[model samples]
Target: MNLIKRLAGLLAVAASCSAVAAPLLSEGFNDVAALPADGWAFINNSSPPGSTGWFQGNPAFFAAADGPAGSYVAANFNNAAFGGAVSNWLLTPELLLVNGESLNFSLRLLGEGLLDRVEVYVSSAGASTNVGADFSLLAAFESPAGTGWLDRRLALSGLAAPASGRYAFRYVVDDTSLNGNYVGIDSVSVNAIPEPGTVALVFLGALALVAPRRLRQSRGLWLLAGGLAAGTAAAQAGPDGLMRFPHVQVVSQPAAPAAPGPGGFMAYKDPVTGQLTGPNPEQAALLTAAARAPTPLLRQTPPAPRPAHGGISLMLDERQARYAVVRKAPDGSVHESCEPAPGGLK
Candidate 1:
């Protein structure tokens, strides 16, 4: 399937299941001055540098693609009003990019007959300001271009992203006063998404010939923080510190005994209070639930500090400890059992 179809399907499933894809960074340029606070960088490399850099977009030229004229960001030849070469740059905040990501933005050029140039660039050097050292042109639009707003997409589908990098808009001209004019940029965004092939595979894998309600409740793929699952899931930080995984629920749990372990680390509990503790709340809940098990459990130990993408295989999904609910019927009957879900999708 195409990206749109697959993305739509993924979103539909993600409404209930955990989702992973989302915008990595977005800049509307609504507040030009606030860019510095948000980590946006501006540099003027014009030969014998010009006095002006990027400023507010002019309403007389055109309104933004999505907001007021002031909402867009613009640059002009005013950098060298008297006449000098110009090579000004406006850079996005630092980003941790990866494969299967895309940069999206809208561009507009003023001065129909005059010399105009706007170029998009990417720098693998994270915070390096030396334009000459590590900048590669991604896209460039020269004079005699269309007068209306131009929407553009630059996919990083081929080159793998570096550890750190940045996208930049470079306004250049041989002679600013004569060749350069005005340009506006708006609706800038960088979206992080799964590879199309992977999305398609997941969408296809989720297909099962089952009842409509059951199908809606069952997905073959479920995403959690930094990982994926179908039968069980990892956990994330929440207000209650509870681990909410698809197809399972933790109803009740016990607090585990606490004491110091090897290397002065608490053993599955807080040393100070002897209360249940964990790498996170969800893990803590799982430790407590395991402690309450009828059979002796594994030697409980304090979780070591996890690195990025590090995961713990801790989950509590059972009738006796977490999921079972006891009910006393109106007719003097009692029942307790785990509710079975269709194919463990939800």
Candidate 2:
């Protein structure tokens, strides 16, 4: 059956059975097939004025895990700008909302030099205002903290719940302008904590699904009872929690453009840290402008003439002297070009 039909069948089954809701919401990089417009905004010590961000790629660049892991949107970090102060680079993704649900999410940031910290900021969407607790993933002077695939799982339980569709995330690299480093993040997913009773029933039901057939029906009933109770209680919890129940399936996705064709001077991830080494925005712009400048060609002009003299034979054939000696008279003139003079003895 087609995917939609299969989905409908699954929904029908879910309606009949007591559903144990899944805990996560994942926004895959390729979900839109193309990168989201304004999904990411970047800044670097090297960005040219008026450019969006100095991310690498012809049209756009994307982030992905080669295998097993998933993919996500990633911005390029130009490390060259951190001439000496410190090797650092920072990037922030669009906001997220737990919408009042507690959160368990995984974040990864790996790059060259030192990745000082990956801080989570809770703020009103579009407003520069901080909402609740500002969380930190790393402390200052933390070297190799998030370097080389540091997998961090965060649980944000007590922060004020976010309203739907409005939240913020920011990553700060210590001494970014001084340090040349970049970060790669993948597979960000949110896990919503289920209520206590709902959790118990989910476990029990899950056990039965794997157990012998005889226990399955009883567990199924228990699962249904728990779901109905949870659903009923959720109605009181208002739209906040109830609405969060569905496994947020991103319905439509765009395919990522094919990997870039083979080319020269590609950036590489640092062995210690997965950070990329590349020209920053400023350097790139300077190079671009220089390449487009017009060049001027020039020709040399001959020197001016000196004054003419009385027939020192002004244009005399100098080569003639080599064959036969020619002597000039006391006057400035040559004696009508004579042959070699005889020696007095001869």
Candidate 3:
């Protein structure tokens, strides 16, 4: 009988240890300048071209008391230049959600007498640059004319099991009219919930420890004890004998193409290949004008005569002047190239 009580106490301790929740992902938007870094992506789908887009920063117009001091993601839907129509999306990094997990986030509304709506979504389909059609609606909320933040939690355990082991969150906002207010989001987190089997194990263990000795000797109690122990072991081992949790990896995107140079020279290279591409249409006209302008020389003396093969040399020099390096092929053929420079520029 003493041995039975000791075993039950051991099981109860194990159950309590296994019931502790683990954090999967947490982000506070503390670094405003690097808002969408670490796999986060912001997408703007506003029509008429001039609508404001989502950005990360402290509230500019109306402040929310709960907003952190550092920074928060926000969108200005009421800009007059764009006619108050705003459609934007913020996506989370790819995560792996095991059974019994929950997502929590906070939202705040800025300004007075303006309405804004936000919808949360989860996708198990695949990594997408744009918000595709495949996603499950998690929750939706409309912020009344106010200046405070609200915390929200969603039980993701109820969602269908994912075959791919990858999931993401999408925050969609639409503030078509009455754009005086903005929306802010911060303190996003994903955490694990204790599995049901763990809870059952704890309850059964306590009952076995306190129940009369005659009850423990009953056949039905013995069967229930065996089942609970098996269930607890199965839960602990997981499906493939490995415990899993959602994890976020930081993925950096390629930098955008450089704009036209101040002197109207098109010195940008292709992002994939290091080959120099054509000029921007807006800057191509400027290039033509600059080409026609008279060259200015510090010294008035006539330039030295060029070599007979100077044309190729001049082209090579021009490529070098634009920070492109020349590489020689294995066959000894000189190839002009504009490789990606240090500090993420090409």
Candidate 4:
């Protein structure tokens, strides 16, 4: 039981580890330089653009997801003057989208809060700065509810295709100074989901390939069992066993006329159980030579006996006088037949 549990634990660990697919793109805004180095763009299309756009993080509001205080990126309502619209866009570099991709990031509202809104969008393929022509909204939500950080994950497969595209985070506020607040984005990751778990299907496919082999083996086994049950000289262990072909078997009987023995017995070697013993005991009358053979040696049923036409008789299979009759016709022709035995075929 302990070994099984340990094996199960190991498989679970492997699946969990395998499930983490390598990221197509990852960004941890450790410093402001990371923006220009990775071709990230900061576009402020605010109506009558304001003074502030994207800027460095400040620990006074909230710490970074990984590094020190100022190791993140932030956007605020200052892009537009008080009571004016703020449309600040933080766009990612162009990426090849082959479908079925995902992204996750941590975000938080900094400083005094408002019911601010941030929206995510994607371009058709390679729309560099034409935010108007190609970009389509992917998601939108109010700022994180608390002062602490919030994690968000999104599936891009539905919106993306086998082309190139860009991701953009748009921070919009109707009134700059009233409902606007600071929002920080950190630890962004884009990855593909992994695929596994094919061994069981492969195993069932293999079984389909071996079905014919099993059928052939069963036929040989049946022939072997039949010979062993009959206690015949044809016994042998092989793929074909004894029934490779049919041949006649002979069971000799003693010629006798005393009160016939009651036991169904034959001279052939019985099985290891020694079940072929005769009807007469040592102190009782001796057994007749025509006593019936054991049930295993029988081949047919019993029929009504008829008088020998020319005083000649014969026997067939292991049936005795009680089970069958044999005689010679007047023209010197021999015939043998049988019907249901005394009790039953057994």
Best-performing candidate as measured by TM-score: 1
Cα lDDT tens digits for candidate 2, 25-88: 5544443234335343332333222222323222222235432233443333333333222222
Instruction: Give candidate 1 regions above 4 Å deviation.
Output: 1-21, 160-162, 195-346
What's model 1's overall lDDT? 0.61
Scanning candidate 3 in windows of ten residues, the lowest lDDT window is 256-265
Q: For model 2, what is the C-alpha lDDT against the true structure?
A: 0.37
Q: What is the lDDT of residue 317 in candidate 4?
A: 49
Sorted by lDDT (best first), the order is 1, 4, 3, 2
The number of clashing residue pairs in each candidate reads: 1, 15, 1, 4
TM-score, structure 4 vs. true: 0.49
> In order, what lDDT does every prediction score?
0.61, 0.37, 0.54, 0.58
User: For every model shown, what is its TM-score relative to the native structure?
Assistant: 0.52, 0.36, 0.50, 0.49
Clash pairs (backbone) in predicted model 1: 247-346
Q: Of the candidates shown, which would achieve the greatest lDDT relative to the real structure?
A: 1
- Judged by whole-model lDDT over C-alpha atoms, candidate 4 comes out at 0.58
Comparing 1 with 2 on TM-score, the higher-scoring candidate is: 1
